[model samples]
Target: MQNLEEAELCFPQLLNISCKKHIRPQAEAMFIYIVLSSISLLTVALNLLVIISISHFRQLHTPTNLFILSLAVSDFLVGLLVMPFQILLTEPCWLLGDLVCALYYLLNFITLCASVFNMVLISVDRYVAICDPLHYPTKITAKRVQVCVFLCWGYSVFYSVMFLYDNLKQPGKYNSCYGECVINIIGPADLVLGFIIPISAITILYVRVFVVAVSQARAMRSHIISVTMKHSSTVTAKKSELKAARTLGIVVAVFLMCYCPYYCVSLSLVIGSSTEALMIFVAFFNSCLNPVIYALFYPWFRKSVKLIVTLEILQPHSCEANIL
Candidate 1:
């Protein structure tokens, strides 16, 4: 009887311990889901607003602005369609069934690759225009820009198809946490080809771009001083060029601030395990930061926002005037 009583007491203790262990993981998962969902929603809304403002304003439709719009579109889709699903199904498993999981992963890969490729194209465009102004129009013609954009999408689709094929063939072979869609082991090859290579190329291109821009700025400054006593025409042209360069600089700065840490964290994940969660968080934060940075730092975007607000305010007034 004494032995039976001891066993009964111990059984309750064991059950309690087991419950606590399971509850902790559940709570942690819940916390992560809530935080990630909030971030995703905020990012999606911001990007959507930017896209709408740019699309509605005819004046904001330059080639550079078009590229930014494409980026904003990609970010918006990812935040709205991908991140929420990921946060909600945090069991490290693909809970949305196989077909949906495959599609989601494929879209994720394509958008991410497209984002990186677009950044490279933007950097190259800036470099050519700033460093070789005489040939800018000829070298970066509208047709050439269209070709570049098409090629970016083509490469993104190709890579995504290949990745999807491999993932589908294996199903859950390389997945972690049983039936999950995550890469069980993020190899060095994956890191290099997927992120590091493109990031390095972008960094080199931007470095050259910076050097050319600085030289151009210095030359413009000297010209302004040399022509200080002359007519204002040359000074006005130089000032316009300076303003354009300043705008480009802001764009590059925001791009670097948003992506540099993300790539660094991703590359580090290839070498260490201590930073897995932190790196994931940093990468996720990149999508959210881009729209905010644009709104805060880009005058063109700010002007668009003002125009949108003004139009909204005027619509009712115009309607009332007509009614009157």
Candidate 2:
């Protein structure tokens, strides 16, 4: 019963209210959101600390550390650049103009793609190191690491541009709620490109890496047993190899834990009409969980924490010596 001009004026406000009502829960949903947000913030802070410590400390600049540094940087950026906007813009209407919304979406896609690809590269690097230790030096040199990092950024930018181009061409297809950026449910293309392909590739790489690592561990144990025929020495080397294998396994496990649910939620959005807002929140939570996983499993991070604690305990004595 309204004219076109009146309808246009009223539409955005209506959409905004709808978005807020949907996100503002009675009780349970708010609790979940708060808990997840807390976890995410904590994870981001931890990753930031880890990255800063590794970068500032000269002793922690090995190849393995370099890969970890890359991972931490990606996680930190996701936490900083993507999650906060997503959490704040949960209302049905976007307060930031269209330009800002578009830019945020673009950056979100780019950083996520970069993170996933970096995981794949890390897995491949681990595979090479475990499967062929001698050739690993030639295959995964510092130069190669730099090249891989460069390619990750380049590929992320290229694909992100393509995605943005496609998205901008059909802006009307998306539901522009304040809190949600629900793209039109395109065919399998979105699902495949956004979630399935990257997850599958990473999963495959990790599976192969696991198989190779287990075989290597067994072979190394057998070799040690045969060489000195001393159980104690064999046990020590076995423990070292086991520790290394466990570290790699934890990395893969963390990747699966933090990302698999996100991919599932994304696929569900593409394939069905479910709660897009909830799914987006879940995916955001994954970005925050990565740092917790690192803290639990990463040996270098654990060592760094201990070193920090020790230095703090020794600080007073060092200060007194300097004064004297």
Candidate 3:
């Protein structure tokens, strides 16, 4: 009985060759399951709302929103495909075998990379709109945004495949025992490509955005008493830009907070420990966090959700309805 408890083979029939179960307390496992499951469901539901809202509403069909739509689609996939597999990974046994595990991590990487790319696109959109408003409309057309989205997804697939090439070539290559699943990351490469480059782009762009926004806000304040301020085209444009920068800045800030820890850890060393699982999941949890931020800050998202939930969108000409 003591040996059985101590060994706790993931596959008892295999005995010596089976992996030992790394079982937590039953209560702790149960809580983790419930939390992760809830996150999965919420992530799916909220991202679907964003997708439907943007796709079905004509008013929401702008360049900035195109980036958001792309992000929603990626988050939707994370919920639909990645999160469930992640939940299974938490289990003591690898019931589905090595190929599925490889697929799970692949899907995970693709969605996350796509999301980061979308964010970069969004920041660029905002940057152009605020910093270079005259050329913004011409520069950020729907076709261009669509092409960028496609490229982002394509790059994500290529990157993920290359990153996990060995594991894809030989499933179970890293497993020391049957019923165990493990994959190691090349920390230095991950830190450079995944963490440093993308994060640097996002940070630099947002910093420029912040500087412009703050300067514009001060200009508005200084001219507040002038009646002409309201009618000034420059003033009006600056106000709009400031508001947009503020909203999207909140989103980018939250993204940094959620993504930082995992990549920060990746910078120092390898990530095959038990604690790495928690860090990865924490980063994955950002998939759900974004839509909640949208719901809180975006009146259009709130209105669209109401319209969708109440089935008002089924009415003919509903897409023509004003969402903004």
TM-score of each: 0.75, 0.75, 0.94
Writing each residue's lDDT as its tens digit, candidate 2 over 127-219 gives 666666657768887777877888888888887767777565655246544433544334367568766777787678768767876776677
What is the C-alpha lDDT profile of model 3 across 31-142, one tens digit per residue?
Answer: 9899999999999999999999999999999888889999989989988889888888888888899998888888888898898888888899889987888899899999
| Candidate 1 lDDT | 0.64
Model 2 global lDDT (CA atoms, 0 to 1): 0.64
Off by over 4 Å in 1: 1-30, 92-94, 175-179, 184-186, 228-274, 309-324
In candidate 2, list every pair of residues with a backbone clash.
19-92, 90-179, 91-179, 92-178, 93-178
Worst 10 residues of 3 by lDDT: 265-274
User: Of models 1 and 3, which has the larger TM-score?
Assistant: 3
Q: Which stretches of candidate 2 lie over 4 Å from their true place?
A: 1-33, 166-187, 223-242, 269-274, 306-324
* Alpha carbon deviation, residue 133, candidate 2 (Å): 0.7
Better of 1 and 3 by lDDT: 3
Query: lDDT of model 1 at residue 23?
Result: 23
